[model samples]
Target: MAHQSKRTTLGEIGEHAAIRVIREECPSRNNGDDAAVLNQPAPNTRPVVATDMLVEDRHFRFDWSTPEQVGIKAISQNFADIEAMGARPTAALLALSAPKDTDVEVLRGIARGIQQALEPFSAQLIGGDITGGEKMVLAVTALGQLGGNRKELRLDAARPGQKVVANGRIGWSAAGLALLRKFEEIPEDLRPLVEHHCAPRIETNRGVIARATGATAMTDNSDGLIQDLRLIAERSGVGIDLKSHAIFPDELLCRAGKLTGIDPWEFVLSGGEDHTFLATTSKETPTGFRDIGRVNKNTGLVTVDGLPPRHEAGWVSF
Candidate 1:
């Protein structure tokens, strides 16, 4: 006897069933309104929202990443944009497209991953749409709240002579991807570093703190650091000089890369998806921030020891 697929029309599934699945898998923080509703603006506060898209093949490989990793990465990248604006993330709207043949269980797993990732930050899922596509695509928009008298730092505010600092490690993801692609055996102790490369540690709170502490400008190290820093410089009418030695990486990871004939500086300068905060500040930067460079008045350019940064290729993207 042949078994029937559970594929039923939305009419047969019932609206409540669909809502229940989402509620259980990706609970929204908006208190079950027909639509997620944000609170009335607090006096003198403005809501900030940003969105980004990730297309399969362009952003990730289905073979290498679990569905959960895919969902988390999608959420993490969009939330990072909110952090770059110096605001605290409050909610996310995700529109996911997949082949109609995609398994419901797999889709549920992706939603579960999104829920889990949002738990730490108290961000809620508002609403989103689903449609068919040739390949998987995730579009996420994150909403945030700006607090107090502090304005979120924008790229335009960078000033000459401001110290450049970074609030997270660099290159871990690039190295991890390399090892994964080469299928080389990594030592047991290096697994964590490799995982960090798969999913770069995000420093959202640090970004918000830097903004409150008077950061003049900021951007997340999503594109290679040099490229992203150059964006800030161009937007702000400044040039940036980064001290190569100051790019922090896990020492053991660095040693491992050396043994494998990989240049650590390449990871530091051109690796993307690190999600680290590179910011300009006038005040003594707080702990956890490494002073990596400085800003100068000029057209956009990023340099190391007066030379252009190098890259074997560049970070992955679609």
Candidate 2:
């Protein structure tokens, strides 16, 4: 859908061609970010739209991440929102802001990240805008097609006896951030976690599987696990008791925690940027999902190993 001189900077080419470089790198269905009609949803399916914005330093650091990684992270988060609705992302619009002196190669890399990230789910960029700003910012709006009724995936739909199931990586991003904060040169093995923090992965087709297997309620773990689960419990008038055995920190996270002197459970329980999917299913988990616990009648209570959390469970933007 959407460069020229070797090592040219944005100041050299100006913003117009900088836009062209991004367009040239990303795959597109329309001429550009315009009134291009998207593919119609499958018969009887409704459209799902989600947006996400990322800011420098707060969301990502240029020193810690490449422009490509930022692009990938930006689109992936928006796509996760669509996935939470049990929908397939089909199109997207990107809005980017940067200083005029920014390097053209950086824009190319960001576009490349967006291009590669959309490959797994077969989505395309339709339109976007670029502007001069004080900080590097990326805003993405994604459109998806839901093959089922919207009410089926509401947060308040969890019922007692439903199994609490989850899929996707957890804690990896937070662990990565910790390592980045503490170390100048990251260990080779820990680099995957850092990579994940930069461009969180979305397991392909798992959302579709959850929908097909009759998910009752679903959410993506953008906030910490306990904090997000509390939202479901509060809204649905139920409680969620998680089994520590089911979601204990894995070997990589344990290693990271040991290195940083931070308990691995802290990462596992409170880490949020991983975009892991949490859902309420029946007794059997859908493919690619693991049963973590069960829903109960006690409303507004989320417990770990049968006890309330020892500390605040998630990130607060305020």
Candidate 3:
């Protein structure tokens, strides 16, 4: 008789067990309730909510990303959107759609990832649903709290004289994707870039800081610097004049681009998924952020040193 493997599947573990796995990692206040009971914000504060969905082949691939990476990516992206509003992420709701044949360990790994990603912000995974599907689909809804008397940052608030600033890594994810596509075996040096593409780490607290320091407008760089800035410019009736030399490219990204024969500037200006924080500020640039450009009254334009970008601006879902 041949020996049999004992791999546990979603069907074997059932929904309760699956919930146990997630709650074990990040226990909810309303553990067994039909809906999570959350604390109401203080006077004058408002809730900031954002959601992101990741489909199997479209947002990620199992061969390149682990279940943990997928979970982290989903949480980080949604949280970044909340942060863009200059708020502190408080909690999240997760929804998983996967094939019944999916391994229970994979689900547990995803839970662990979500828990770890929320650790820095003191956020919790409050509630969610799990269902069967043809491919793995993860949807994360992140909720945030905007505190203090400062106004919430909006894209339309950017002004003509406000300085453009950025905090956190940019272009690394796009560079990573470029390397991943070109080479069968990624070099050891390039592993960091690949990891960045799989799981980006944004500056979570800068959102609140930007608010306190009087940010005129803000946005996350998930859609590339130029593209996201264009959104601010278009919404605010202003143009952004970026200094060509002001946008710094990391050495690793430059090397990656050189090796792949791709322009590093393209990744800097057009690549998405970095999730860095970008803002227009009236006061001095906040600590942890570097000056990149200035907002102009020209409106509806984003230029690099007075010239339009040669490459495309950013990612388009359609």
Candidate 4:
């Protein structure tokens, strides 16, 4: 089942059976072997592949996010990368490394989360591996397909005079994280933001829309918006000027900012992990996307309304 599992802790499960339990308990389709066999892409299609890793304490915390939520976020983030390149995910492999003292129930929860994340998309969980380590770590490799001669939304394809468009929530995860760090009893109205921080729901079809709508470049806003756009700016050798009024915080983010004594613009401008779709289009903005900025001639610069933003440059891994 992708939702429930037997509740046995890691200490009770013992060391030798950890991998075996993971293989047996984790959900899959045509899996549970030394390796996985995947179907080739359909005719007139190109394959897309992406990987993302989640480290305990570095990327997530059990006290803040449930085991199931961590599992969901791990897979969802990887899927966001696949879609960012304008591809449809077809299969996934999850490799996990956790400590010997870890709970088997946590492993089951992660597996269930992975399966649940795949439910909305066409991808299948082909296989994975489990092993002992210093802490919990999850590495996911997702394989995708771009079909029908639609061009890939490469980051370097951006051009001057293109309109930058965005779809989905901006700064929600950051706002949620702020709440989790500061408040013990989160307000009911703001709890959803916190939940989003734990397990985000991405619109998997947005990348396809960008490809079909003549988008030249695209990326997911995993880092802060400006930081992520800078990738396109660097590769395409164009500047991207974001409109503050266009991407500025909504009422909830404003409320969170007021309560936290931080600028709401910081959340909108530099907050990371929202996985919102960002694209540069020469044609009219897609139906689901809103025009947020314009591509300009300034080389490799991302500005907010013609000036550098005041927030930090998104999430830094080092």
After TM-score superposition, what is the CA distance of residue 84 in candidate 1 from its true location, in Å?
A: 1.0
Task: Give the alpha-carbon lDDT of every model.
Answer: 0.75, 0.86, 0.88, 0.86
Return the lDDT, model 4, position 19: 56
Tell me the tens digit of each residue's lDDT in model 2 across 15-120: 6897789779875758464476876567978888989889899999999998889988998889888888788888888888888778888889999999888888
Give all TM-scores, in the order shown.
0.87, 0.94, 0.96, 0.93
User: Which candidate wins on TM-score?
Assistant: 3
Question: Per-residue lDDT tens digits of candidate 4, residues 80-104?
Answer: 8988888887778888888877777
Location of the lowest summed lDDT over 10 successive residues in candidate 4? 20-29
Clashing pairs in 2: 1-27, 1-28, 2-23, 2-24, 33-127
Total backbone collisions, model 2: 5
RMSD from true fold, candidate 2: 3.4
Residue-pair clashes per prediction, in order, are 4, 5, 0, 2
RMSD in Å for all candidates: 3.8, 3.4, 2.0, 3.4
Candidate 1, residues 110-174: lDDT per residue as tens digits? 77777776777888888877667778888988888877777678988888899998887677776
